[model samples]
Target: MENESVLIRYIKTKKGLLTVSGILATISTVVQFIPFYCIYKIIELLMLGNYSAEGLIHWSLVSMGSVLVGVVLLYASSMCSHVAAFDILYDIRMDLLQHLSKVSMGYFSQKSSGQLMKIIDQCVEKMESFIAHQIPDIVSALIFPLIYVGLMLMIDWRLGLVSLVPLFLAVAIYALLMGKTMKNNKVKQYHDALEAMNSNGVEYVRAMPAVKIFGLSVGNFKRFHQSIKDYRSLVMEWSNGFRSGYVLFTTLITSVVLFVMPFGAFLISQNPQDKTLSLTVMLFIILASGTTGPFMKLMYAASTFSNVNEGVKRVDEIFAEAPVKEQDNVTAFSGNRISFEEVSFSYIPGSPVLKKVSFELKPNTMNALVGPSGGGKSTIAQLLLRFYEPTEGTIKIGATDIRETTIDTLMQNVSFVFQDVTLFNDSIEENIRMGNRIASIEDIRRVAKMARCDEFIQELPNGYQTKIGEQGVFLSKGEAQRVSIARALLKNSPILVLDEATAYADAENEVYIQQAIGELVKGKTVLIIAHRLWTIQHVDQILVCDKGEIQATGTHEELLAGNPLYQKLWAINEETKEWEVK
Candidate 1:
């Protein structure tokens, strides 16, 4: 409801377009009464006096002109309203996107890609229906109904009261049936759609290996089909409720109109001397059935607009998210030194994952954060990136706390390459150029060639212009990683966060990737989180983090000297990688 009010305020801001649409709407509604007035005047003149054919023709022409005016107004209103609606939707989506960008990385960890996408979809749908359909329909339909009811009362209050009984029943029934569904139906439908999208997205990732082992050329579509079937069942339930309710309401409106209309005509004729009862007013009674147009229009409007409620709820959920925090006295970067002083984090409160953890990395040095699985190694990089704020203590870039700096400023010095290698379904040049869109084509190509993607990119059918398919699906894991390295290299930030940047590489590819890393680490501060033993061997320092604390911190050789965990893990991996057996 707050979202609705905000949307209304936004729409009202476009005064010129809304005013035009309103004027058009008014013209359309006024003409609804004009036709009855025209028939009464034209017919009475013929019955009473000379009733010249030309005079009748003149009245008929006026009526035709009114009809034409109504048509023009309707068309204009439709066009202008649609324009405003689409523009509003576009602006709302942009606003939501901007808000999402401004919020901290903590928000993303708690939100799924599918859920956010669902929110976006709902925002668009709500704006479209409210701006495009609901507002205009309310004016057009409600005005006509009020005019009909008012005129009926003017003719005879007694008959008017009688005439509205079925409508009263219909309105009561509609409220009982449809109003009961207002809240839950929208929520149910929204979650159903979200579940379907999430399921499909997850299965798309998880079912890949099985697909390849079976030599399947295309992804199995059964999961997608099941999701659709589930959605269909929910929709059917929703539609059935409205469909049955509509039939009942329409029948009641019809029965009331039929009973009251004839009885009123009979009552009027009994007293033929009541000359104030004009023929025009009498025709209104005859056309009382047509008066149901407004009620029918309202019924139709409710049916269609129920779908928009789900959209509005989704939009509301997005808008409810709090904005990002702002630190008043932000500390700017001092140098490239990184440190964690008893810093720790957890996804949920109370059950802490990382306890009081601390470490420091010297400027322009390679530091490896290593441990067994479920250790807090990746979590350390996540903290440096400020994806999740530490639960306790502090993380500092240079000598300043990360919390003391703005996110953009903090990230200004950061270039993180994670396990996933996601590229847009775009050209190789454009994908790498995302590091900095304004970078020169020459620089982009230089970075690409440096990262070793230049060799394979040139071999592609479209060379640098080759489309990488969705998420770079056309490229193998190692190939995609090289492209990602090219992106980070082009970024040229002071701090680098590399998490398994060479995981997919073969021996030859690994050698090339390591050299790329060597060039990457020349002057920038680097933090490495890896499972591979080779990645940790020659780093300037190694911090083994587990369960949110630094279990050991020293040179790899020094850790093997003192820490049994580090020593045993190293022996296992080193033996696994030995060139020859004893």
Candidate 2:
């Protein structure tokens, strides 16, 4: 009941439809039993020598009519349940996505795409089966046996008690099966194996290009190979663990007649002249056999319930994650002067990425952060965008603390171009329009020309309408970077953060990208995580960071002469300038 509480909220939305389905299923169960009762009436009439053509026809027609009505009601019940199931599935998926959008990027960093995909796609889908088929089926399955068994008891106490014996044994064996499964943690193991397999399979597909180029075999990919092996082992173990109990339950359920028939025959043999006793025994035999099917169906529903319960629990876990909180009264910034005062952070608890670091970028100034690869330069940029919150201290824009402002306001003011450019599998125009949704086609083209990607875009088969990763219209790394810049330019935010915008560009592309950035930072507060020191030499301020701390702040020449660490980095950079491929 506790596990089902989480799912109940989602179910409540379509409770009316579910209720109708259940009611219809109940009626169908009662109507289905009428056929068996009508058969008994016809047999009694014949044995008592009270048969007539009209009576025989009436009973036979009643039996067939009952079956038809039952079928119609069952069909209507199924239709209602199916409609509710699909609508609920849609609502669950939409809610999941909405909740995910509120959580921090750090949550995504800790989870894989495959793991999330399994929860979003497969786990939520399991609820559809339970709602559509199992819900209605369970209603009928539970009611059918109760209705007939009660009727049997009203007719004769001895046969009714005897009929229940096999059912009780079947229920006991099923309970034992469930207990063994839970005790062994079968449900958890089953989901874990599936998540592992899905994760590995997605990785294998993504790495297929590299695999083919390197002539790699399945055996060489240990993670994927081991996932398959683990799944096989788990399936074998799960099947074997329940095999005996399942067989016993099935055998007991289907052989209900075997138990009741012998006792019924003994009663009839003891009272041979009593025609009523003989007819009662025959009726018990007919009804007891019918009860087995409902019990079988119930066992199936119970098994599906366990799996779906596990799946819904996994979905609930995603919803349980805390989202980034927002202030009730947000403070608007007065200016774009970005400041970080003693802002410390760590991706992991004890290993710090940025430690008591502080910096400032004055309004409309181009500032540069130059450091070694893992020296917290990029972390500083991410912190400004609130991809993560600092462990201590404050980041402010003018007189306003960043935490006091809404995320939408902060995002609208800042435009970021990542070191690794991301372009969707969409048209060139649509991809650039992501920055400013209301930007005109001319606006997009103007920025594209400024970023120097206009010529290649025009040369494509469909021009700006060409789709990426389709029709052989893929952009090179440098071309993609230019498109990314065009997007940021279109945004035209008051503050800009560039994390190595030209890191992967060729010399020609670098020249064009620099021209684009020259236009983008005209009236904005800019922060650049620079790799090539020469590019940012003339910026207003340069901060050299080392080992998660800002070691020095100065102009290019001042740092080169006064800081030993800066001098060493400069020497290394200069040496790399002369290196050439053999």
Residue 295's lDDT in candidate 1: 79
lDDT of 2: 0.89
Model 1 lDDT tens row, 90-186 = 8888888988877667787667666677667754766677767666776788777677678778867777777777788888888777676765665
Residue 316, candidate 1: Cα error in Å is 3.3
Give residue 158's lDDT in candidate 2 (0 to 100).
86
Clashing pairs in model 1, backbone N/Cα/C closer than 3 A: 354-548
lDDT of 1 at 347: 75
lDDT of 2 by residue, 1-582 (tens): 445555788899899999999999999999988888888888899888989989989999999999999999999999999999999999999989998987887898888788899988988888998999999999999998788778878999888988888888899989989988888889889999999888888888889998999999877889989999999999998999889988999998988889888998899889988989988987887787687777888998999999998888888888888877778776778999999999899999999988899888899999999888899999898888888888888999887888898888888899999999999989999999999999999999999998888998999998999999856587888899999999999999999999999989899989988998998888999999997888998999999988999999988989988998888888888888999999
TM-score of each: 0.86, 0.90
Worst 10 residues of 2 by lDDT: 1-10
Minimum summed lDDT over a 10-residue window in model 1 is located at 275-284
Show pairs that collide, candidate 2.
none
lDDT of each: 0.77, 0.89
Best-performing candidate as measured by TM-score? 2
